[model samples]
Target: MNWSWLGPPMDVRPLFPVERGAFLDLLNTLTAEDWERATVCPGWAVRDIAGHVLHDQVRRLSADRDGHPGPAFEPGEALPGYLARTNEDFVRTARQLSPRLLVGLLDRLGQELDAMWAGRDLHAPAGLDVSWADPGAPAPTWLDVAREYTEYWVHQQQIRDAVGRPGADGPRLLRPVIDAFLRALPHTLRDAAAAPGTAVTVTVPGPAGGRWTAVRGAERWGLAPAVPDGGRAAAEVELAADTLWRLASRGIEPAVARTRARLRGDEALTGAVLDIVSIIR
Candidate 1:
């Protein structure tokens, strides 16, 4: 189905609010037993994933208004270790509350976040970095929001898949999620020493699908609409929509996605792209 909205904002900042509503709608239809269903997140059940989603919104809301309640980590702990410990702690704590309590808290905060972004200038200098990309380097605020939207959208999909409920697969919703995840592609190949102007193309073939090229620049690789006229792509990778999401999110094994992906030209570059992940470990 064509999920296009009337002149949907291409900025992607508007996506989080819409996706949150869609997820809430799905949650409303679930039974108490449904909340206990196992999700693709391995150990996390439906309620656990929902609680994680709630944790994300709550932290985002707090960051916007007050300050982030920094994670409880021991001395000598790195961010990755700290995040894993804290997220587990958050989920465990959330499990104490009923599903209704989790849903209600998310609902109230999602709206507050929606209003906060609606008026914010996306081009303003952002203190946040897409950590995986140039760690500690400031990134565009729009990119930051795009990353958040992808996270929100994907976790919800995990819940949907567990419950046998399909969602956000239409052109409009699926496209943005794909686009946002690909933003990490350039960053993923940062260490791969490709010649300047070498390009890599990723195509997801479907009605909602589009092709994107990542061209190596003097300093880094960046995304573009297409390779320059007569420019041959250094590598090309093709994947199905569903498989693409699983691969990009690290939800599936690389060996598994390779069975479904078609790669041409530089195998190494394509491998790097396939290994790209939007979320932190």
Candidate 2:
């Protein structure tokens, strides 16, 4: 995933209005029982997931206020335990709010995020470590935020799915977010020891003709223009965009790559590709 190609580093402001609108629109249509349904995220119900999203937004503001990059849970911290605790806090805080109040909270959070990034220069430092839900890995701050958007967008889909609703507006709105996820690949590859110079191609089936080729070099990884060679890739692996997104987001077994991806070329290279793609998000 060559996320750097998503273009200039700007605040996530542009996504806010659209995201908020979608969130509100979705909320207005939900039944009370819809909030109790379980989400794909293990052990979290729909309301819990909603609370966590809102909680993360509040925490972002607090982190900004405290003059820290973000929370850094210590090594050996129990990932699920921490998530449960934080989620509990969020649900408690939001418990008093009606569905309309929850919508208002999300709207305000969106506005603040928009204002925070509006007309501001926010550059992610190289190799910044950020705590994530995964215990085995910590992500870069930029990737951390990118994952947040992915979560918001994907879970928005999950909410829709639970209610038998149609998909979000279209792929165009998600291109930038997808690009951000792709851009994090170098870090993901390096962390997984796949690095650059290992020849591999990742094909994401499209709405934007999604596909990418990442070649590992001596010093760094380079992303080439993605051109599918008519199913004749040197080392080809194909997956649906949603499956790739879920794999990247750590929602399922990384080994699912073997079953889901269509692979060809050296078996070792296939392993490398799996390793590289598995650790992202």
Which candidate comes out best when scored by lDDT?
A: 1
Clash number for candidate 1: 0
lDDT of 1 by residue, 93-114 (tens): 9999887788899889888878
Clash pairs (backbone) in predicted model 1: none
TM per model? Answer: 0.91, 0.76
lDDT of 2 by residue, 117-181 (tens): 45343454423343322223433345555555666776777677666776663675566555555
RMSD of each: 4.9, 4.8
lDDT for 84 in candidate 2 is 64
User: Clashing residue pairs, candidate 2?
Assistant: 1-182, 3-182, 3-183, 196-216, 196-217, 197-216, 197-217
Model 2 reaches what TM-score against the true structure? 0.76
TM-score of 1: 0.91
- lDDT, candidate 2, at 64: 54
